[model samples]
Target: MYLQHFALTQLPFSLTPNTAFYVGLAPHQQAFEVLQTALAAGEGFIKISGEVGTGKTLLCRKLLHTAPAHWRLAYLPDPALSPMELRWALAAELGLQYSGNIDQQQLHQLLQRHLLLLAARELQVILVIDEAQALPDETLEALRLLTNLETEQRKLLQVVLFAQPELDLRLAKHQFRQLRQRISFSYRLRPMTVAEVAAYVQTRLSIAGNPQLRFSPFALNRLASGSRGIPRLVNVLAHKAMMLAYGRGQQQISWWHVRAAAKDTEDVQAEPAFIWLSAALMVVVIFGMLFWQWGPL
Candidate 1:
């Protein structure tokens, strides 16, 4: 709604994980490097886990778009598949064509054949699974078994998983020991620091063609504090704060805008103690201005 007021080419703080808005913050950059190195080394299974809104899906997309020409990537945005369904999905990703009446054993043979064929053609086949935390126990083991098709030097099929921290918890159990052991490389994505969030917001604004949008120091602090460094929360608060400012025909965001936005948003932590102190300070400033205007009336 405020795009014209801000002179932005697009909405900067969209919740969608748009690659164009991606900023290579330290944690995301490190994770990307880890993924590249691991995939290049032909690792069997690589896992990346993070808390909610940590941008794992965006990182996965970045990898998909930037992989080397020799790499063939297949992406599964959902991972709640049964063992039989999982095999069929892999077979499809590998370019295997078959009728729906095929049996499980037959599908397995087809997957192995497709994997070997891809290897012979010197293509690196990678299966990227997003939201892997929902993967069934038997499906997880089935994934591990798929990596067993090797040519004595490297794996024929490689898998990369992007998931929430729950996946790590589930993998810690003894039942998943074999699957856990196959994860040759892993990375954990952390929430951005306050400074990083500032840069991230600036980067997104710049990409949206309005680098000059302004936010006061208090506004920035409230944004960081309320969002607790979560990228998704940051985007939500920032977007709403800007809209509030625009509603008042103001060119800059103040803490008041952030406060209102934070209160309206769901799942944002209730204001901490320091925020109350800040609010009190703002009240004092407002009363002080009124007194000056009316000669202490």
Candidate 2:
């Protein structure tokens, strides 16, 4: 709604993971490089994890889009499936067909044959699973077993898991030691820094065809602080700030607009009211303690 009003071509802060609007800030760039290098080396299992709003899904989509022709990629965005369901999903992704009445043993054999077929054709198959933290222990073990499907040289099936930090905690347990050991490479996507947040916002704005719409330095600082350097939160704050600016027929986004946006957003950016309230509570407690230690005059 604010696009035309702001003279922009597209909504710069849309939640959809559009690769074209991808900003190569340090963390995202490092994650992409790691993905490319590890996948090229045919690592059996690679992992990328981050906090909830730190852009793991965006990185996953970028990997899928940029993977080399030799890579036959299978994407599983939902990882809640049981081992049997996971097998069926994998089969469907790989375009393998079998009778509905097929037993687990037969299905496993069929899947193994298909993997070998891909290997014979010189294609490297990679299974990219997002939200991997939700994958059950049995399904995770099943994935490890799938990686065992290898030629003498390299694994026929590689897996790249994009998940939240909880996945790392799960992998650290003794039961998952084997699966954790097989992860040849792992990258943690960090949140954007204040400076990077400034660049990131400008980058997205430029990509959306409006580089001239200025966010005041004060506003940017407010955004960086409010978002705590998280990209998704930054997007939400920025979009709301812009809409606020547009509502008042303003061209430049100022700290006022950002503060207002933060106030409206749900725990995204810190609100001045909340900060002041906390400060007041702290002062009251300190005074109360002083009165208890030394009687008021």
Best by lDDT: 2
Q: For residues 227-250, could you state the per-residue lDDT of candidate 2 as single tens digits?
A: 988888899999999999999999
Cα RMSD for candidate 2? 6.5
Computed on alpha carbons, the lDDT of every model, listed in order, comes to: 0.91, 0.91
| Model 1 agreement with the true structure over 1-297: per-residue lDDT tens digits | 999998988999999999998899999999999999999999999999999998998999999888888998888998899999999887777678998998988888888888888889999999999999999999998889888989988899899999999999999999988888999999999988879888888889899998898777778888888888889999999999999999999988898999999999998877788757998999999999999998767
> TM-score per candidate, in order?
0.93, 0.91
lDDT of 1: 0.91
Clashing residue pairs in all predictions, respectively, total 0, 0
Candidate 2 runs further than 4 Å off: 269-297
- Candidate 2, 249: how far from true, in Å? 0.3
Query: Cα miss at 7, model 1 (Å)?
Result: 0.9
Query: What are the per-model C-alpha RMSD values against the true structure?
Result: 3.2, 6.5
Which pairs of residues collide in model 1? none
